[model samples]
Target: MFTGIIEAMGTLTELRRQGEDVVLTVEAPGLDFSDVKLGDSIATNGVCLTVIALGDKRYSADVSLETLARTGFAQAKVGDRMNLEKALTPSSRLGGHLVSGHVDGMGQVMSRRSSGRAIEYWIKAPADLSRYIAEKGSIAVDGISLTVNAVKGDAFLLTIVPHTAEETTIARWKPGHRVNLEVDQIARYLERLLQGGAGAQAPSSTLTLAKLAQSGFL
Candidate 1:
């Protein structure tokens, strides 16, 4: 698990096809890549990847065919920047919203503009994923936790502070660029609860509010 706060920006060092899979290499920034071990999970642009090898200041992970197809990761060229985040420990403070580091779908950057002292961006998301987005709701974009400033059909907008733009890859985004997105964990839980009738009496059980009050269980 992770809090979608980006720790650093990593540059793509190499990407090579190895039979049916692709190996992705990234140059870590300001972070100690020495401690990164094999099988350690790291978020690369909101996509959870297991470290397969560690270099001087770079690390490598193998990307499956599914990842390449679903994430538009195959389009990542050398030197492209990616938002990087280490997995959270039990003692780590969750400065951002809960993130599974699992990219649900790809969203394209529609526009990036200056909004006073902040930077505002618009992204076009998949039609199905649009329902999960709400104004002021938490959303993880490329591993950076942000609040939705507004929603417009299949697209949404968010504001980025200067610090965020400098520390992460938001500043590098432009029209047609793709980003990973993850919805709020609480909303997913709510959906499951409502769908499964969590904590609610089954139909035909006659467990109405008045009945519960009379039963001293209200």
Candidate 2:
């Protein structure tokens, strides 16, 4: 698990295709990898990747076909910047929301503008994933944890402060840019629990306030 807080930005030094999988090599000069061993998991742009090889200032992980199909990695290339984060330890603080580093779907940047000192971005999520998003909920965009400022049908707004833009790759986002999106994990699980409850005559997808009150979630 991860906290979706980006530790550093790494440069994609190499992408070598081997059969159906691609090996990604990143140069993380500022990230400490002295304690990282083989099989350790790292979050690269919100995708959990296992470390296959390590060097003094670099690491490599193999990307499976499923990951490439579901994430922005399908469009990634060498020299692109990647948001990097180490897996959370038991003692690590939960600075951001709990992130599984599993990209649920890809969202597109629909619009961008400045709102006083902050930058406001509107992103359109996939139709199937829109119901998981709520106003004031948390979402990980390209591995950066952000709060949803507002939500419309299949679209949401995010306000990025100067520090966030500087720390991650949000500054490079444009209207047509695609981003990896991981919706709040809790929301997805809740939906599953509601749909899979026993003794129900029929499975339901509707979420109601009365149901929340009965479930002690209100």
Candidate 3:
């Protein structure tokens, strides 16, 4: 699991295609590599990639076709900057919401505008995932945890302060840019519980406007 808090910015040094998979070499000198090991997991742009090779402030991970199909990595290139975050440790602070490093879907930046010292962006998420988003809800966009200031249809709003823009890759984002999106884990679990757990169909709702009126709720 990850905290969705970006620790540092990393650059993709190399993208070597091997068969159907691609290997990524990321260089992040600013990140602490002392505790990182070959098998450790790192959240690269919100995707959980296992470290396969380790070096001096650099590491390599193999990206499978499944990940490529679901993430923005399908269009990633060398020299592209990415938000990086190490896996959560037992003693680590939960600075952000729980992130599985699993990209639920890809969202596109719909618009951007300036708000005082911050930049406000509207991102259009997938239609299927819209139900999971709520105003003031937490979301992880490209591995950086942020709050949803508002929601409209399938799009949501994010206000990025100067510190967030400087610390991560949000500054590089623009309209039409694709970003990895991971909704709050709690929302997903609640949905499953509402559906009556695994393998159970969603319970049908019998309440309606007429029932509300009968109960004096209207």
Candidate number of the best TM-score: 2
Write model 3 residue lDDT over 1-218, tens digit each, in one string: 99988999999999999999999999999999999998999999999999999988999999999999999999999999989999999999999899999999999999999999999999999999999999999999999899999999999999999999999999999999999999988878766654555576657655555765798744
For each candidate, what TM-score against the reference?
Answer: 0.87, 0.93, 0.91
lDDT of 2: 0.94
- Checking candidate 3 for backbone clashes, the offending pairs are none
For each candidate in turn, give its C-alpha RMSD to the true structure in angstroms.
Answer: 4.9, 2.9, 4.3
lDDT of 2 by residue, 1-218 (tens): 99989999999999999898899999999788977899999999999999999997899999999999999998999999999999999999999999999999999999999999899999999999999999999999999999999999999999999999999999999999999999999988777677666566666656766889998975
Error of 2 at 112 (Å): 0.8
After the best TM-score superposition of candidate 1, give how far the Cα of residue 65 lies from its true spot, in angstroms. 1.4
The models' CA-based lDDT, in order, is 0.86, 0.94, 0.93
Question: Which pairs of residues collide in model 2?
Answer: none
- Over the stretch 1-218, how does candidate 1's per-residue lDDT look in tens digits? 98998888889989999998999999986766655788999999998999988878788999998888778587888988888888988888999988998778899999989999899999999998898898889999988999999999999999999999889888888899888888887777655544556677645434455764697733
